[model samples]
Target: MANLPTLGQRFRRGWNAFLDKKAYENFNIIGGGYSGPNYRTILSTNTEQSIISPILNRAAVDISMIPLRHSRVDENNIYKGTIDSGLNNCLSLTANIDQTAYSFMVDVAMSLFDEGIIAVVPVDTSISILDSSSFEILSLRTGKIIQWYPRHVLVRLYNDNTGQREDLTLLKSSIAIVENPLYSVMNEPNSTLKRLVAKLNLLDAIDNQSGSGKLDLIMQVPYAIRSEQKRELAEKRLAALETQLKDSKYGVAYADAT
Candidate 1:
């Protein structure tokens, strides 16, 4: 029993398991990806890791908060007075029955930033051709682009009234597609941000191991587990390591022989 942990040291170990409830409950699916296997890992990573979501959310909010107006610029493309237009009325008064300008823009901007593309489908409009003079929006919905076509595209638009996603195929004329603002950077197959997300996702998967049980790791104590002082120090170090592993965004702890 000399090499074994004393009773008090064993009791101290239980403190490390305090934050294990979530890990325990989600033992089967700690690091599982989102429903689709396509390009949504960045969004999933945003949920788990605290690296990118805040910036994206803040950008969306800031962009949505900006005042929008319909205006005619001068011949030199300089600032001109605002124009009274139906477009301005539709955008400012009501994006849809359930959303204001800010809410609608938040959804649009978030999708554009997170998924790189969003579809603005004209749910109800005055004209099919959308002629500048006659075009008027009665209602609109923001949607995630599911399929692309020359003349039409499929989208999954969330209905606020029903609280569910409604799939719709919109003709090219009835839908406007907005891509990410940083299209040049995000369009790359070898996107650095995507690579970082992949790495974080893999790390998250590894971290799931700790959710089920303790890591299959060992440490050779520098000296004998004899004196009370050494035992306490060793226990302190082990408890710290355990807490670090459990409490980290991804379960990783750094240590070296010191």
Candidate 2:
């Protein structure tokens, strides 16, 4: 009889598949939040650390992709579970840094989760059709399940003739759902959260810097194209000048004199 694969083997297999899939999107942009009424006053009066004291103990900007785990309590109130049980279904943005900063981030994430500000499930990227108002996703790794009901869905399209355009739609019925306080800070004009998101996105764009100290070649495409155009224009002008000189009567005289 053939033996089944070990738990470690299964985990390794799942992790490899997840890496191959590039399933995680930028959480900083997609993650919802709202600032409380006292946020403005806090910013004005508190220090940087104090500002994030509600969420974080230290100010560190690191990016992390964490898988969500499911846990349950028994009648005795003892929690028992396996991380692998939910490995397949969803991942969260735990923290930006390594294990050194993991605990801090996890604390913040859990606090946020308890407050019902944001769900700990992975961001759903595959739902292209809006036929149903809500849907459930199961993780292939852990066989965990997460239900999603999008309130607003935004899609952007680029057209050469028309430039870039956005289509924003309200997906759900007009029912009041408590929004995450972080979203308010995100939407506020000239807010720290907005600045942080911009910075994080910029960092995300250049996340894969090579050992040769080179950024993505897509960034250099515009300059390369411009250079090629200039070279072609210079060549055309030189060709025209040569043609003019050859076509003139003075051309023969000049050639003979030379």
User: For this target, which candidate reaches the highest lDDT against the unseen true structure?
Assistant: 1
Candidate 1 lDDT, 1-258, residue by residue in tens: 469877998788755567657666863454433454221123445333356667768887899888887778999998788776656765676777667878778777877766788888766667764454356667777788899888888898866444457787777666688888684454344466667778988899888976868557788777898899999989889889999988998888987686
Clashing residue pairs, candidate 1? Answer: none
**Residue 225 accuracy (lDDT) in model 1:** 87
lDDT of 2 by residue, 121-229 (tens): 2123234335553444322110011234456433221111222222333233411123346644422345665566577667867664534433232211122335777
> Any runs in candidate 1 off by more than 4 Å, and if so which?
1-50, 74-79, 127-133, 160-163, 181-258
Query: Which one wins on TM-score?
Result: 1
TM-score of each: 0.50, 0.22
Would you list the C-alpha lDDT of every candidate in the order shown?
Answer: 0.71, 0.37
| Clash count, one per candidate | 0, 15
